[model samples]
Target chain A: MVKLTEEMKTAFSKVKIFPVATASKEGVPNVVPIGFCQLVDDETIWIADNFMVKSLANLEENPNVAIYVWGPETGGCFQIKGKATIISSGEKFDKMKAIVNAAKPGLPAKTLIEVMISDVFQCAPGPEAGKKLL
Target chain B: MVKLTEEMKTAFSKVKIFPVATASKEGVPNVVPIGFCQLVDDETIWIADNFMVKSLANLEENPNVAIYVWGPETGGCFQIKGKATIISSGEKFDKMKAIVNAAKPGLPAKTLIEVMISDVFQCAPGPEAGKKLL
Candidate 1:
């Protein structure tokens, strides 16, 4: 299985905020910074649904998503593309809630988004730019 | 006409890199960190395409784009949604080339993407979160 490289995981772990992209059924694109995006296993990602509005709606209409990973502490930049599953109840969802509420008391973290990463691309500007890593 | 607020413009200007979102005609979402995303006017943005591949292809297939603006110096966060027009040759394209080449000589600065801002939304978490401003 093509999973996140150690360097990519290290970069993903250090960032507190993330930019998640989604598109409506009609194809309108939306991107927003999310704070509760977490790594789950090798090819999975967990995003707590706390403040999502249009993003959630878009996801319901279209499961496709692309997440950008890069920032000050991150040594490199990458784009992770995946198919998302919205989970409102279940063991994983409950675990996500606990993690979220622990970070901020009273936070609902209403839902959990399970993203199955299918592709990873290099975003660094160079000859390897846009190269698929997985 | 709705456009970027002064505060929003200020936030957009200070960022060294930006997250730009686009989708394929098939509705698959893609997001990448772009260093050349620039504010052109009240409702326009100029992105010098020094190195864009999938992003450019996505734009060609679907003009819709979403850009996330936020960072250390930005007081707040916002998502700028727009329709992109690609220009490979033109006066504005020439101008973009000069600006891009000035920053990095010998760069191709391949194309110019002009984004016409159609909607602006709050990305901050709160009651006003996800509220459209434009």
Candidate 2:
């Protein structure tokens, strides 16, 4: 299990949108901007599936996923790669549904995606860019 | 070949950063934020490799790529999926090298990645979200 540093958590919290990427078993890639992603803990992230179609399909085919978090104002970028599990009905799903409903009423929180982070990478443009952080 | 709509072009132009996703042939995923990306044409996008390591390695193994662009102020999001070609030393590479140099001096424009867009999807949070736009 990988642990997220305090700097990484702070940067992720500041991001308004998270771009989540997933690949099918055939290697075709899909990316989507998610507005309802929360860092549940250092090693876990919860993404509320509001309108995810291709991403969900890709996840079903291949559990591997990558999430990019960047602060537009701060210019901090990080990539979190991990395995994702789709929770349709569970306590975590219920909690995520409540959060999503409170944030945007009438939207269906179909599934709550739990990502178990295995690696983290720095995405900022510099010498250490793309270097594994965890 | 696919054509980009005027709305898509405008939204992409307004984005300050582009998050690009790529997967290895084994389906391992990598994502990175790129600051030097430009739309070359309706169906082609150019990304300058400033500080890419895993992303470039993933591209070499699998050409498939996905790019996510979102406007912070307008909240417009689009996902562009395509096949990428890395140009190390060529006319396109030279041109991209010039652009990258102008944008950020001393940064290595190691390669110019040309993405041939195959599909475009709407990523806004609504009923039409995740719908095919092109």
Candidate 3:
């Protein structure tokens, strides 16, 4: 597993929304927009599971997740792939709950998904597109 | 399959960049930022394959695709899922090439992916999140 670079972290932070992609055990792909993903550390990211359905179901079967970090203000582009662990308890879970509740009191923020980064790919236009960066 | 609503078309047009997700035959999920996806018609869309690798390969193995549409100005959020057909020659292909070449003459715009939308799902962060609309 590779750690996300400082540049990648900064670009990720500027993103307003990104897509999280997952696949079921049957190899069926599912994707949804995510707005509560946080860069927890150089090697980990946290996503609040407020209203996931197929995305959560896919994760239950296949732990790997792919997130595309690109928006008008993201500065640059990249893709993050990692193995996700669904956390329903413990310290990180509690912190995630607090953060979501602070922003919107009614958001369930039911669980926290902790993703340990394994790969990062350049998604910027031109020759570097799809090149592995980490 | 269902046709896209006029409202969906309007919102889809506002997105500058969106995420296109695909999976290998073995179900390994992959996602990348897309800037060339077009709402060709109510039930169809097109994506130019200017720079692609794993994404195109995955589509060859499994044509199903998922695209998340959401940006600062998109007005609404939704996910489009469909079967993708890679077009390398003929009418749509020629049109796609012309559009790409006109915008940037040097771009290869190698192929055109015609997506026949089979489903639409709300992704506006509510009880309707992931609820299929079409």
lDDT of each: 0.89, 0.87, 0.88
Error of 2 at B26 (Å): 1.3
| TM-score against native, each model | 0.96, 0.95, 0.95
lDDT of 3 by residue, B1-134 (tens): 89998889988988877688999888889998777889888999899998888799999989989988887788778988899999999998999999989888998899899999999988889888989899
Q: Where's the lowest-lDDT run of ten residues in candidate 3 chain A?
A: A68-77
Off by over 4 Å in 2: A73-75, B73-75
Cα deviation of B79 in candidate 2 (Å)? 1.3
Calculate DockQ per candidate and list them. 0.82, 0.80, 0.76
**What DockQ does candidate 2 have relative to the true complex?**
0.80
The positional error of residue B56 in candidate 2, measured at the CA in angstroms, is 0.6
**Could you tell me which 10 consecutive residues in candidate 2 chain B have the lowest summed lDDT?**
B69-78
**Native-referenced Cα lDDT, model 3:** 0.88
Local lDDT at A36 for model 2: 91
Model 3, A31-93: lDDT tens digits are 888889989889999999999989998888899899988866877788898999999999989
How well is each residue in B9-108 modelled by candidate 1, as lDDT tens digits?
8888899888899889888888888888888889999988877989899999899999989988998888888899999998999999999889989888
**Tens-digit lDDT track for model 2 on A1-134?**
69898888888888887878999999888888888988899999999998889889989989999988777564577788999999999788999999989988999999999999999888777899888889
User: Which portions of model 3 show Cα errors greater than 4 Å?
Assistant: none
Candidate 2 reference-contact recovery: 0.82
Compare candidates 2 and 3 on lDDT and give the better one: 3
Q: Is candidate 1 or candidate 3 better by TM-score?
A: 1
Off by over 4 Å in 1: none
lDDT of 2 by residue, B8-84 (tens): 88888898878789999988888877878889999999999978898899999899999987875545777888999
